[model samples]
Target: MNAYQESLKIKRDNYSALESAELRGEQRGQKQGEQRGIEIGAELERAKAEREKREMAVKLKTKGMHIEEIAELTKLPIEEIQALV
Candidate 1:
């Protein structure tokens, strides 16, 4: 083949390689973003659950529940229950 034709083929191959690389990079970025979103969601859920547990502990404490019983019933640490008192 002529030099002109060979050069064109090389350019086409390079362009194809660049396109493939760009597509792979986008997919990797999307996956990473999805994973980050999942992590944030889990963290939010954990925070909400912790808040609810603390509220319940406070209510139980107001009702004159024993610290040890509150700890056992709520599955919270004894220290945490005592702190609420």
Candidate 2:
């Protein structure tokens, strides 16, 4: 083949490879972003649940419920329940 045609072929191959790499990188980035979003959502849910449990434990304590029973019902540590104001 002529030198000019060979050069054009090489350029076309390089461009195709670059495009493929970019597409792969973008797909991986999107997957990572989605996974991070799910992780954040789960953390928020766990934090909300923890807050609810603390609130319930306080209410039970105010009602003069026994500490051990409160710990069991709230699934909070005995030390945490005792530390509640």
Q: After aligning candidate 2 to the native by TM-score, how far in Å is the CA of 23 from where it should be? A: 0.4
Which candidate has the top score in lDDT? 2
- Candidate 2 regions with alpha-carbon error over 4 angstroms: none
lDDT value, candidate 2, whole model? 0.97
- State every prediction's TM-score relative to the real structure: 0.86, 0.86
- CA lDDT of each candidate? 0.91, 0.97
lDDT per residue (tens digit) for residues 1-85 in model 1 = 6999999999999999999999999999999999999999999999999889888999999999888888887888988878884
The lowest-lDDT stretch of 10 consecutive residues in candidate 2 is: 1-10
Runs of candidate 1 with Cα error greater than 4 angstroms are: none
